[model samples]
Target chain A: MLQKKVLPRLDESLLTHLPPFSRLERRQIRTILDQATSRRYDQGVAIFDEGAQADRFYMLLDGYVRVVRITPTGEQVTSLHIPAGQLLGIAKAIGRDSYPATALTATESIVLSWPTRLWETFVREYDGFATETYKTLGHRVGEMNTRIVELATQQVEQRVANALLRLINQTGRKVEGGIEIDFPITRQDLSELTATTLHTVSRLLSGWEKRGLVESKRKRIKVTNPHALVVLSQG
Target chain B: MLQKKVLPRLDESLLTHLPPFSRLERRQIRTILDQATSRRYDQGVAIFDEGAQADRFYMLLDGYVRVVRITPTGEQVTSLHIPAGQLLGIAKAIGRDSYPATALTATESIVLSWPTRLWETFVREYDGFATETYKTLGHRVGEMNTRIVELATQQVEQRVANALLRLINQTGRKVEGGIEIDFPITRQDLSELTATTLHTVSRLLSGWEKRGLVESKRKRIKVTNPHALVVLSQG
Candidate 1:
């Protein structure tokens, strides 16, 4: 069973800066918050699983979530890494009755969720809700299209480089040596992200480490030379 | 030049059955039709090109369109085949200023288009316009995700089989021998769609032809045994 902790009441100010709530008045934001329930999840917790009935939608308030898809052969593919202040498990927005992918917390995170039944009311009554939600969905579609093209045209090495670059762009933090991915991501995760085998990922990372292009140790990856990776990805 | 020929005023009946217009009342539909311009595109005509200013969005009223993307190395990839009664060039909805891909007519087609400036008005005013439009975008995203998984996990032959199956399901018509793709699709197009070389596609199709799986001649392909292809795709 998944572990969760119900949080205290949410404040409207907590949501005022979020894209989905940014356009609403304070009263409207309060109304939205009144309908939401906040909870905290421990690291590595699966918030929802693919093919499970989607009864609620969430907005991450604190940490990162990995959107995962399991193939027919039981191979796990890490499709996306979602950050704080964004919505997740928006099955209703997509007109799906069940979650399309599993959401797993990469760090201890806090999220606010609303029952799926209120999705239509929120879309119709809340100003800018539907527009912002659709915008987010459109952005996701664009990213998926780009990944499809990359898989269809680019070489494996290029794809791996692009995947790292994308990760750093989304969740990078400046460290002493270089920019480090802010979460504990394994080589196996990299392989899953790039659609390659762990052996290939290990080999490539070892080579990159020797060349000083990146540094990897203990489930952590830091890009020492992002420009080099960018150039490699372009090819 | 795009060979422009502006036709007479559009009748509201032309849009009643389309998803974007289905929930709209007759007068509201009339208002929408008043703002749209209908034009006929010849086969192979480019409706929009990638990176061009997205001044307008279109609804395909008749025939089919091929969504194309050219990689950095200038290799053209056919990402999708869009059939009639669907919206295209929806850059505004995606928060984009330019078209992401080129839309090319696969057959002589008719399209109704409106200025991009009116997108926000339509979304906010129409009862179900945003809901339906986003639903379509969500469906496309789902399709893109499926293609991504197929590219990442499936073998070359399986990918080819799945692509053929998708096309047949979308635009196939019953013929004496089997079900034929409703458009003239060349081997080159199949190669691009499946992310393989044309020679490989030719060899595979030839092998399948010998196995009584499919028939290909003069840029037309018919599935003689979809069940066999389905089984191959599963593996």
Candidate 2:
């Protein structure tokens, strides 16, 4: 969970952490960051909602954020979780003047909000801004490509397995026995994320529990044999 | 289809064709274009392959390109067609270091290629470079989002109708009888694009042809009732 004071310091260090920004470019980044505002959110608080106009693009100094799409039944399909040092908003930052997805604080989060116009200005004046943004763009497109393949090619079981593996790889917190998903995600959330029925997930988890592959509590699961789990995922 | 000479003078003017590029930004873009090398691809040439390492990025000066992926059974899925004025080799330009999809020229095409490192430099040094790249990134991500929604929410009939709409909207070439898809495409290609089977596509086309909604020959299909098709798509 992200809860820290990170937005107050308008420094080149944060700017250089992303691609293509050198120390000199960091000075210009400082100029831009100085103009930014700081914001914090408690766990489960929404940073922004779907369709919000792109006013500010936030850089996470500390904490994690979740991007989700709310279904008709009020179910949230967790599309992705953004940890520290990654960008928080881009759809609105680049186009359509809108936030395409909803953002919620997964932990205590500290964020720096720059006037969306500042991003535009920096993009105009700084080469680092544009290239870094492009790199970010490549990543977003790659992700969507993977998701399309998942939806079109993989079945429910495979999708769930891959999703869990992805979570473990990207945002898992190591424990004594195994790795726990850093976010406090529920089975229902997992079901929506995989586009499968909750009943199916419940059954699958029960089976995995008995097989000593995973341990599930009310809203958490600890992966045991990650490699074997991946082999099962191959099925 | 795009067929134009890659003249450096066109860089400033190309900005006029797209929105959001200020006059000064146009000049900045020209610098990036100045580094580009002109290349040509004959019809049926493979510009890049799916899963291949992406090393360079291309901008179409002239000709049509088909972006495709191959399945395990050797079936090909037509992902998208690139027209003139659009950038190609997106995965490389965006820094994936690999081609996400293959680019196959439908006709002889003129493309401008930049050294992968130079492109990275431009992304880092040129202001317009990063913003333009981010915009391109936004465009691809938005396109993929539409595909995800279509795959999840739309029925097969509606999907076909929407695909026709998309084809017409992107690259429809009007002929004597009606609107023909700009490239040489088959029912099988259409099936792959819409994620349905060829037999189902054949049956659907037959039904539409009977209703005068669309007409098909050996490999071409022309839309007759564009509005009616829209209604069908909405259904």
Candidate 3:
């Protein structure tokens, strides 16, 4: 069965990283992409809201967005930040008809949204696309498991540190002095993102600033000592 | 898009519950049944451990099993105790090569463990299999979301009531006096399942026993005043 190798030649780099889309048959994906439409979202715009009917799949072209779940008490908990080149609104595209969470534009962004039925076409005609999509689903399941563990076991301090490290690792840019977080995120926003109270977050930031691990001014945060931040992640 | 109708039948009664498979699709699933190899476990048997390489998925054939996770401090937590007909060890079957949590036998039981690769093959080769599998995945995602909400907001006592309610919903048996829990589970196990200490669990159980809301002795528990239990859940 392995030798049959009916699947198309895969891009080696993608196979080892990201979803298993590396194995996709190129011609099939090209056809689907030809039918997709792109649009732009302004900063602070609602890309979609919780309980909204899910009917389209979106792939980001530029900028970033936050996927958030609003608690019953009206508190918003940020689950993930989606950046350019990543897919959003997958539940809509994957056959479900309701938005799982609200998507808020973190910056002005370009996105490609395709009709949900287009996925059916891919699954029926393009084995490679379906295979890759399933692989993406698998990756999401693993990620959720990790989140569940963290939510269940990790202390608030560790969760906050992990959130900071994740933001820096994914979107930090090096400047003349140190690495800075790209987004104009506030401490209250960071508190919601980490599922902790703002008071604790404020105290932690103050502590970090005193120790010279990070610098905070206005709406910006800069990481002066990545190694020190890692040590703080000790659970 | 509404005319596209991904699920063609859309029957009120069936979709409201569970839909029947296409005849050919049922046959394919039956073949998975043919390949299924059953194993027996006596009570208290540890079926798998968290962080173990995920290899196989299990379908309970008889009796019951409990899903467990151990904290960093070596405290055991029981996530769920489920009976026959429900799937177990599914984390590995979808994509993970390793199991996420430990499973223990709640009673003398039979389970069918299948190679995950083979399950994937069945999902691909069989028509409508992918559709059904995706539904299962969606259902699990919904269940996880519910767990997340509970962990985030619910008190420990509320959590225990909810846990018992869930277990009763899944596997309880009707008797002359009340609903039998249908599994031999101790208060310690209940504590683990609810993410609290055993002493707290014992205290709650004792309180319930005094109120005649439940009957408990050693490893047995029966819900007598379900309405009262619901009040406890609310309070």
Candidate 4:
């Protein structure tokens, strides 16, 4: 049987700076720390499965977690990547009994988790916590709505360009030539993100490389000319 | 100058019955009603334009509003529709200063609006209200995530079928023949919703009609064989 007591202690300051928590008082923050425990996983491990009981939620401490949904035929599509210092497994906050998607480790990862039962307690007790959580939800919704419109209206090239821009914006790291996506994202992941095929993504990347708009090798991508990519995305 | 006092008095029960409000106390409910005002718009009129200051937010009372985003070249794509009893123009809740998308009336509409300045007051004073609002935000994000995955994974026919099923679930009315989408949704609207073209939508609907799976005329669509549609969407 698993035991909370045996878990290694973690710095409480990690929770204090995260949004929803940044709104909580020192005492409330301590209460959350008391209820939380830390865990680490190797890359490619499943943190939780789709349709599993969402009895708990997690906040990342280090590394990446890819959120994915398995199609009826058992094919996995990458939905989004969760980086360190953000929350995942939030299905319970909206009163769902099961997770809508599976969270898989994309890199060696550390996460701090809290039992779902305490979700209501925090919402009831902390205004900043509730407001910030809701704000995060709203922003995500808004981003998806934008994607829906883009999918309906933009061409494949434009969609690919926009998806790349979004990925870079979310997790890009400053580099000499330009910004790198800051994670290992395969071509198939970009295809899934933009609703295109791997072949199309490859062809587009080849064209962009020839034009010096971007540079890619294996799973890494860097925007060599972000302004041009932005222009292309607008079309 | 637009005067809030010139608006017609709305039944406070409209706010009382809505989510977030449904969770608030009677006194709190009265306070919301005091700060609110009713407004009306004719079909095809813009309620709020994209990039406009989001000084207030709205909840529908009657008719429909279509959320849209205009592309760089002036193409308008329908993002989603808001039926009576849901909130719109909620940019401020997420900390944005301007509306992200334009909201236009799909039919003659009545709405109750509250100033954005009071958003914090409500969240701070009423925990249930904040929770419900966040819950709504979370649910919307979840739905959009589902749509993104479907767009990435499903074929056009499957997407169209799923979109119809979703619309029917949201606002269907039982008819003698089948379940009919309640609003006057044009084929163009269906095209936008499903990320297909008008020609493709027309062809699909025509094929469905010949097979008796659905009957669509003008702007109305009735699912004559929901089971078959479901099966088709599963593909």
Estimate TM-scores for all models: 0.94, 0.80, 0.81, 0.88
Roughly what TM-score does model 3 have, to 2 decimal places?
A: 0.81
lDDT of 2 by residue, B1-235 (tens): 3334445354566544543234346566677556667777888789889888777777787788878776554656666767787777867556578898778897788787766777656655654555665576567666666676666556889888998888877879888767888776688778877888889989999999999999888777788888989999877
Best lDDT goes to which candidate? 1
lDDT of the structure predicted as candidate 1: 0.88
Docking class of 3: incorrect
Candidates' DockQ values?
A: 0.62, 0.36, 0.21, 0.50
Question: On lDDT, who's better, 1 or 3?
Answer: 1
What's each prediction's clash count? 0, 15, 5, 0
Q: What is the per-residue lDDT of model 1 for residues B18-73, given as tens digits with 9 covering 90 to 100?
A: 88889889999988888888888899889999989999999999999999899988
Q: Positional deviation of B64 in candidate 4, in angstroms?
A: 2.1
Across A1-235, the per-residue lDDT of candidate 1 in tens digits comes to: 3333354656778999988888889999988888888888899889899989999999999999988888989988777889999999998887687888899999999888888999989888887787788788767777877888889999889999999999999999999989999999888888888999999999999998999999999789999999999998998
Native interface contacts retained, candidate 4: 0.63
For residues B1-235, write the lDDT of model 3, one tens digit per residue.
1122223322232212222134344445556555656667789987778778766777676799887777666767565566676567766335556776789999998776676767667556766545655665666665555555566556888878988887787888887788878888888788767767789999988998999989987888899988888888865
What's the lDDT for all of these models? 0.88, 0.73, 0.69, 0.81
* DockQ score for candidate 3: 0.21
**C-alpha lDDT of residue B130 in model 4:** 59
Report lDDT (Cα) of residue A135, candidate 2. Answer: 74
